[model samples]
Target: MKRSTSNQEVKKLNRNRVFRYVNSREETSMPEISAALSISGPTVLKIVNELKEEKLIREVGEFESTGGRKAKAIAAVRDVKYAIGLDITKNHVGIVYTDLSGKALKHERVRKPFKYTQTYLHEVAAIVRRFVEESRIPKKRILGMGISVPAIIDVQRDYITNSHALGIYDVPCEELTACMPYPCELLNDANAAAITESNRSRTCSNLVYLFLSNTVGGAIIFGNETGIVRTAQEKDRGSVYMYKGNNWRSGEFGHMVIHPEGKRCYCGKIGCLDAYCSALRLADQTDGDLERFFREMEAGNQDLKKIWNEYLKDLAIAVDNLRMCFDCEIVLGGYVGSSMEPYIQEFRNLVAEKDIFENSGDYVYVCQYQQEASALGAAIFQIEKFIDTI
Candidate 1:
């Protein structure tokens, strides 16, 4: 009887593994799951049945069979587990409501006035509460909340380390979100964007993603994955800096001193990458006439073309440097990447001209989602955390 119990325990563990693997993706049949996991039919069915009873997996539809009965499709009850992704920028707060599958059901934004205080946090939290209430998703289905902030975050401290633009320093994230109905998590904006980008681009294992909006930042994927976790008050040290090279620190990319004599950055430095690669910089180049510059570029104006070409070259150089250091795919994102459809090839060509690597041809790609990339990625990260805990 003791030997029989050991076998039963082993069988139970195998079934749980199969259930997890299948529930990780979109709906699939038992045979497809068995083939994917290399498990026997009986074991898969036994495990799936147990999962179904637990209300973790459910029947979706039916699939055609080779020469037997129709196979039933199964999928994770993703709608039953929702997540919220908030992009807390210097000038605005962008919030998105999504289910476990990272589907954005709703989105909203609040403007940032030049003069504001920590009260802004409260205002942002209110916006989140309103969105969640409007979403009408059961609170029990919500896994948790993931917040993307445009600042260096001390994840262990649960506080913003430095955000000069917002005049915030070492403010506890949990304290700000104390009224939140669920658990809360914080990620650097750029890393959050990169996490979202990496999830959608499963084709590459290693990649660098740039977030170049009101501020500039980067996210690195060593093995095409983001390991977002939540621990105790000491999680602030949870950064990739100690893992990557010296130059690969998270928000420090924006301060790379591209132009020693150029305009001053929010961090009180001059001619940094953020000073050159941001939408604000582009707007500044056009004297706050963004529409005019975009029109001129679309109209093929020679002067604007020269400026754009220079911008692309600078961007290409940064990407090339990152590519050499990381030896992975490079992605362009942020407000610039959203409008990159017309110039992605232009940037690629420039990078190809100067890349030191032999496989430069396959190392660069554009981000799939432009506007909501970070929000979706936050949702994905939260769901993965939820799954791991379960």
Candidate 2:
């Protein structure tokens, strides 16, 4: 037989349950929590009072009266604590501070490239620390730090398997996060991107996220509650799945050999989709001048327009393939996806023309959060985990 729980254990469990119940609802009353947990009215009152005293919850308003006394409404004070999410990229590092709701209060980006030195880690850590200190939140209330990086991460092992852009090999991400006051967690950028997309588009039941930036990444969303993205699940936390299969590399869709002997890729491959469809490729098409290309596109330059059309065709094809494979919403993200907003309809129309699906025009579209997605996604990941523990 299972050992009987002590009063203290029961109280702790009930307290956590009450807190979670309140936080999950849009608005709730003390009596509602009491009824749901089958606890005494006085006991629920005591639990809620403690949470309010801790500044973790607050009275939002009053509920409609039922021909008697009106009930006071309560909701989670997400700002009582904050989470820091860092998106470390090769060319830049995006740092953001957000509440439990994934609302970014303040954010700043450092343009410096990744340096494999103590200086780099220190610089990133110091910026994050300063942001936290300025938020005026107590250290104890702060949730753990979440980091998103475009690398092969083994979160269980607390180390990065490989980061091509940063030239990192088996670096312990936890070690760097430990320098901060709160606990640290590492996540893959693609997985984080998928989380952002899922949160931004509530209507999508399942998703296949494609983040095509300087490097390519992907995420798979199974439903609202589950982030089926390979790197986000706890069981695969410390495991690294190297891309060993032919015709199927993890998010290295950018490096696919579209042409037998085309432009060389950074990975020493030829005719890479990245070589043909990336922002860098677009810039190269304009003779290494991004400003000129953008300006020309804006000015309705026929040549640039033609090039963009061809590039977007390749992107649409990629999306079509992902949709066929996952049978879910296809969300495009990253800096390039942000700029493609005005052309979303055109892209959709082109996909309709492809007619891959029997319905023809029933293809999914791009993400809503756009550029800030990965950072916000990293923050949401922490928030969801924290709620689960509660």
Top-scoring candidate (lDDT): 2
Worst 10 residues of 1 by lDDT: 233-242
TM-score of each: 0.84, 0.77
Q: Please, what are the lDDT tens digits per residue for candidate 2 over residues 168-232?
A: 87788865566655677777787777777675554436666677676666766566334345422
Name the regions of candidate 1 deviating beyond 4 angstroms. Answer: 1-20, 114-118, 224-251, 257-271, 286-292, 359-361
Index of the highest-TM-score prediction: 1
Per residue, candidate 1 scores C-alpha lDDT tens digits across 241-274 of: 2233343245357777767887787777787787
Q: Name model 2 segments beyond 4 Å from true.
A: 1-55, 66-69, 134-137, 174-181, 202-204, 224-252, 256-262, 285-295, 359-362
Q: Show the colliding residue pairs in model 2.
A: 156-238
How much is 233 displaced in model 1, in angstroms? 30
TM-score of candidate 1 relative to the true fold: 0.84
